[model samples]
Target: MMGPAAMLLLLLLLFPVASAAGSRTLVFILAGQSNMGGRGGATNGTWDGVVPPQCAPSPRILRLSPALRWEEAREPLHAGIDLHNVLGVGPGMPFAHAVLHSHVLPPDTVVGLVPCAQGATPIANWSRGTELYERMLTRTRAALAECGGQGKLAALLWYQGEADTIRREDAELYTGRMETFVRDVRRDLAMPDLLVIQVGLATGQGKFIKLVREAQKGVKLPNVKYVDAKGLPIANDYTHLTTPAQVQLGKMLAKSYLATL
Candidate 1:
């Protein structure tokens, strides 16, 4: 006895409910500075057109609000290229696909990466006092809401500290702040098992590297794990990772996360 319009609305509501009852979703957050944001040269490779089969096809990736100031690319390739000519790969795409390949993901899993990273931003900016963290948190919450609301945060991958290396006095404080940030995020997301992969800076920044390492080691969070990159090949600028380095870094990240599962 319902009108066509009303029937369509009922179907829309019921369809999502039916889908949710049987679907499994996992969301991953990529948070850091330029390295995690992916600054590297383009390359011709087999992964050029490779989109993770587990991810939804055609616009397989989505940018949620974009707290960072850099240009965004949904595909792994660099910006300013036609889809037909896509020939580059960013760290996120391969990393997510690797998770799928390793069978570490749940069935019907749709990996959502919330990239909140800026070039040259220090750890202090990511703290609670600044607007950066607030912006990232807002984007993160909105992304999860779109997916299905709370409990979607599967993991957080953090690769930062190059800018923070400039300030020696704040190194120890930075570690404490990181711990607090992780605790707050876990508490807010209500996912205590939310794994955190913190990648150490590979830019060869002097004493600060040691401090950051110590800080990561000292953090008492059981869910947090530090991924080492002590001898990796950083760019000639002495900061960013080159194209090959990014690929290696991505593989390392993928391996670490898979081992946990």
Candidate 2:
């Protein structure tokens, strides 16, 4: 049996479409913990909420379905990932909207979102060689395969670290682990200079929150940028970003990505 990384490489080789996907299909991966998976609403653990107009589904925006195929993009981008329960508004939608409307890419380009976020998960869950990491890699490969030789990964939108804020050690070592994770992802995907937009932890478990946020903002690496989540509105639970905030954050992510391009 081949490892997940090996399997993905094989898939890329076997499916010429993966590499053939040039710049016609702009691909992005929405990753991280609960916030990224989207738990925001008037109620907790429920998808019941108002869908912001900015996040309205567009035929041009496609998402990686659970079946490992591309389909019309929708809210709660992480629905395909099994670990998340509630599927509410996530930042991916607004981010896509911003990119589509912005002058970053050609007008004819289509956006492909690969959702692999798991709610409430810690950084350790996404550590290299972990199940979550392997699953994410496999799904990413499947998304590339779905491109049909016309798409390519543009950037990665990461919003996480709340869970890791609970532990002092996790908060302390976050910078190193996160740097490693970014390096590993880029290297494995054969994109040495892939753009990685890491969102800073807005709020979390009391004392350690600052540590994680500091680590996030202080990360120094090529092709890696940090987006501030400070002052972002929160849900009723005060954990996840509210729908409006998600939209704002998504736009912020898009702006950050566009600056790089």
lDDT scores of the candidates, listed in order: 0.62, 0.83
User: Best by lDDT, which number?
Assistant: 2
Identify the candidate with maximal TM-score.
2
lDDT of 2 by residue, 1-261 (tens): 889999988986775333434338888998898778876563364677678888998877888888887777777677768463767888898998999999768877888888989877888889889988988889888888777677788898898899888889999999998999999999889999999999988888546999999888778999899899889998767677888898899999999988987
Model 1 spans > 4 angstroms off: 1-23, 42-90, 149-151, 204-207
Using all chains and alpha carbons, the TM-scores for the candidates as numbered come to: 0.73, 0.88
What C-alpha lDDT does candidate 1 achieve relative to the native structure?
0.62
Q: Taking the candidates one at a time, how many backbone clashes does each contain? A: 0, 2
Report the error of model 1 at residue 52, Å.
13
The parts of candidate 2 lying over 4 Å away from their true place are 1-23, 82-84
Clashing pairs in 1: none
